[model samples]
Target: MAVGLVAVGAVVGLEAADRAFPPPLAEAGMVSAEVQDRDGRLLRAFATPDGLWRLRTQARDVDPRFVSMLLAYEDQRFYHHSGVDPRALLRAAFQALTHGRILSGGSTLSMQVARLIEPREARSLGAKLRQVLRALQIERRLSKAEILDLYLTHAPYGGNLEGVRSASLAYFGKEPRRLSLGEAALLVALPQLPERRRPDRNAKLAEAARQRVLDRAAVAAVIGAGEAERAALAPVPATRQALPTLAAHLAEAARRRAPAVMVQRTTVQAPVQARLEALAASAAAKAGPRVSVAIVMADSQSGEILAEVGSAGYLDSARSGWIDMTRVPRSPGSTLKPFIYGLAFEEGLVSQETIIEDRPADFFGYRPRNFDMRYQGDVTIRQALQLSLNVPAIRLLDAVGPSRLMVRFRRAGVRPALPAGEVPGLAIGLGGLGISLRDLVQLYAALANGGRPVQLGDGVEGEPGLVDGAPLIDPVAAWHVADILSGVLPPSGSRRSGIAYKTGTSYGYRDAWSVGYDGRMVIGVWVGRADNGAVPGITGYATAAPILFEAFAKSGVGLTPMPRAPAGAVRLAQAALPPSLRRFSAGPAGLVSARAEDAPLQIVYPPEGAKVELGTDAAGATLPLMLKLQGGRAPYRWLANGKPLTTLSRRRVNPWLPDGAGFSKLTVIDARGRAASVSVFLQE
Candidate 1:
């Protein structure tokens, strides 16, 4: 009875000690963060706080053969023992006594994990005793699988690489999920003396160690004798490979967003990203020094980014590669012309074969010229857009109103950056506004997906999904745009890729952009100096368009047919077109043959400096005010407070809605570009 009491007291004392001084299990959670592709392939990995490449590894994350080999070599009775194997320890002790040396140190996987958790420099008896006790506490707190996971995560394999996953990536350039027989045996033998047997530095030691594990496995019948012999003949890696760094910008962004997340999964495809990055680098190199390139490829239907290359080289300081050019706002040149034509088509004001003047023209005070300083005189709406003519686009923008275009862009989930205190204007159609490559890609996605805008997500911020809002343009208009763009000839030395595309060059050659899309994918490319410096001879068609074509060719995705035409989208010949649709006129009047004899434009009603009372609705809201005008020509554009009204009017009587009771400056421009203004005090 006395002895039983003594035993109970000892058990109570052990329990109290275990409760007071728990193992440092939190240390096991300090692992490196990883960014993976859609298929869970590692894109990049960041070191831990202490600069160690210690990736978290579970039993399932490793090859089963590796786990079996590790158990057979490290601890034969690992599962049978609670923490320390008594029979193995006794045999080890007996062997040391008989051999007069330490032939083996019988430490179970759990005890090794405990030592790794709280490392000690000396191999003293006290250290061993502490490890045994800690192992017992660990086994009591964790299951067998958990214990194995801890061992796999904490085991060392060479300089700065701690864990089987890290070792496998560093030495074999792949994950530990599917390792070869030789690779698995090498990893199983590495933790015993990681530095001494590092394959990159001590190749002979690593080979010898791997051979020993294979021999032991063969003797224990864990693997066949012939298999062990074959494995033994496998060569050890003599060099270490760097972990993947594809999508560097995106990976960094993801890491910053969720710093606490151990694994960040993105919608990017590894193969596509890798190919595009190489293409960007090659393109930039061919372009010249101090040149950088950015590319973004996404699915038009789902809006998921398949690949995004932010720069030519992530570490090229000469090209300012650290900057993410995909997100930078730069002049968009003539890329926005398609949208202006789209709006015109939606309003039924123009058709593909409609004749439009492309000569130098003035809108109020803004005069736009063609890109090559040469005019095409008169060209079809399709030819104007295909040629990227400037004056025709400005005329279309003036007719449709820039404010309406801005609203359409807003509906597409993008807002172009305007100069401070300035509103959207005619120059915007000519790349006067600032937009990013990503934003441009998003805008073109609407055209590819039947006028439905898609909001793109970077797997880190949000998700790619269809947005519920006003259509960017009607389905018929969108189809018209696709038809015209698809007919644009490819650049020299490039075969046609049955996709619709457009190109733009920012003013002064500061930015080059090309955006293209098919039914399935949309890719946008930008090439220029990141510092916004001008490249003398660089133009979108020459610099950016070629890269775009090559990117699509090398992207490994087959070209998908463009969407078929929607209802009422038939392309009529010039003769068959309606009288109004046959030729685009600045005014409702078909043409003004003599402008000198025309009456001067004037607002007859609401005479200058007059106060007018506005009628209010039942909800106490001010109603639109009617203003009459006797104009120089038909088709007058009205603007109040520097904002253009939604549509052009040919009836001379136009309505203006006041936001509230205030003085508003109302201006009207006639077809001959004649303008008149009136300031009226409006009161409800």
Candidate 2:
């Protein structure tokens, strides 16, 4: 019965083999090839359906040492075998049966290549017989050198790496040709158990597998015993390279735009990218758990983004896979103030010397206060901007009209996120509208580049404007705004000042911003909690300004002072005395009389010098000068030659009529008891 059953089984197996026999396997063809930049280095690979993960070709010449080591460890008789080795298969089958599980693969290099090229669905007993038949067919059709080349170029080692070229780069972080003997052995050992032999995940197991390759190489006489020993003992150069979080983000972005088939050529510079990564890493390390940082660096002249750092580390749980914060929109705080001011200047609604009241005022229920809650009563447009006085900015915003400012912002590439039907108010000047850092940087660049709005894109040229001929704003106005901004550096309190900048804090300190430009570069910085919570006791001037200064100072971009305004483009004037000093007079004997209060105040000469005689006919004649008081009230008393005259009400001054050529002193006492005296010459 047993003999009959064996005959039946053998007959059935023969029948199954006959039925399973299909057409001989053809050589695996290329599928898709992808090229990408890894940490600024270019890498290319080919993907095949049935091979490892992807197949990659050697860059130029195959590294003979790597090939020799792989052949020695994987298939000692690879050169002599025709696709399949019967003797090795019998030995492997015996070991598997005794162990009750498969422990080794006795397939020759050609058989492995067949497995790689053919579908795994063909792995049945009958399928294995077919694979053997196909192996014989492949050997008959291709030469030994061709088979070796196909195997080396098409086999998958691990992790999206199809061939030895990619495996060399992925595993050892070096080219195949540059790999050392031990490194080559490491690659050779990985294919047998790719997952278990990953160096990053299983160092000990990988090391053990590496030793197995060394042992095999020795047995095959691929290397001398001493050489093999030395190679095994050599340090593995154990460093692992990982893509930084920011670099990874950029890579992913590049991949998205081009996919696996198209190669991406970006404007990102490797050295600049390295520096940006370092800066982001340092910032992340310093910021700790609560804070995350994102940075974007671009060329001011060309608007080419040179570098970008998205986060501290790619694997960081808190920030990993988050949308790039640098590109996202957030409340710009005071960073938007310059644009508003620039618009006002361009429209001829205000100038650097224009007086702006900085006192407390409400605009449509929104009352903007200075960061310190301190008010400056009256200041020039230049001083208000330099000091970042909130009240003055709010007043200026009201004067310039919020709708008009919004139009200018849109023209500059900033799409403000203000609600429709929302009345523009003082808050608008304080960056109440949402804006992106990219937009802010571009706006500032417009000012730096002479009023030309930069077209923000990978390589698109900005439209020709006032600077470039499209005329978004008068180049002169933009230049004037730049001049005012250039004086805002080092903060109002810092001793070192050379930068024109503006600082802004959002409601509750959720965001802080410092945006500024020199002749050559425009930079904007934002500091805040990623969660949109206030940083206790921090403001734009205190937080973002320092960072901006550091970036510019370290960037090696020299500061070029903005061009000065023409001789008569702007002028300055001091506030006049209070109304009480308008009328007061000095007597003939150099005495000031109480009755002089009714006399009209006038200047016989300018301050700092005077000549007068009370009896002179010229002295009795009225002078044309009059007193002008600024925004406050104060008491005043007039004196001639150290004699007290009549007390004058706010802004009240007495006129002086000179009689003959002589010098007379006039002293004016303020409400605070402060006195200023001047002498005028009485000329006939």
lDDT of 2 at 386: 80
Residue pairs whose backbone atoms clash in candidate 1: 333-431
Candidate 1's C-alpha lDDT?
0.87
Kindly list the per-residue Cα lDDT of model 2 for residues 1-684, writing each as its tens digit. 999999999989966764576333344545334433324344333344544434435424356777788777677787788888888888878988999976766778787777777746844667666567767767877788777766776676656556676566666665576677788788788877777777777878888888888888888878777877878876543544522223556656555655644344455555555665566556556655555555555555666555555554555666442555566677877777776677556544456766666777655467678877898876777888888787766655554445546545555666667645454445777777677776777777777766676655432123322323233445777777777776664854455646667777888867777776676566667666666766676677876677667666655446676656644344333234223222212212112345433333333223455222222112233332322211122456666667664557443323433333567677666555555556676544
Predicted candidate 1 versus true structure: per-residue lDDT over 1-684, tens digit per residue: 999999999999989999999999998889999999999888899999999998889999999989988998999899899999998789888998999988888899999999999998898789989999999999999999999999998999878899999899899998999998999999998899999999888989999999989888888888999999999888999898887899999999998888999999999999999999999999999998999999999998898999999999999999999999999999999999999999888766689999988776656678888889999988999999999998889887776667667767878888888888666777899998889999999999998999999988769756898989667888999999999999999998789988899999988888889999988799999999999999888889999999999999999988998867888989999999866567775532122323311657776556798666665433445556656564367677889899998687665545567788889998989888989999989765
Per-model TM-score versus the true fold: 0.88, 0.58
Best by TM-score: 1
* Candidate 1 accuracy as TM-score: 0.88
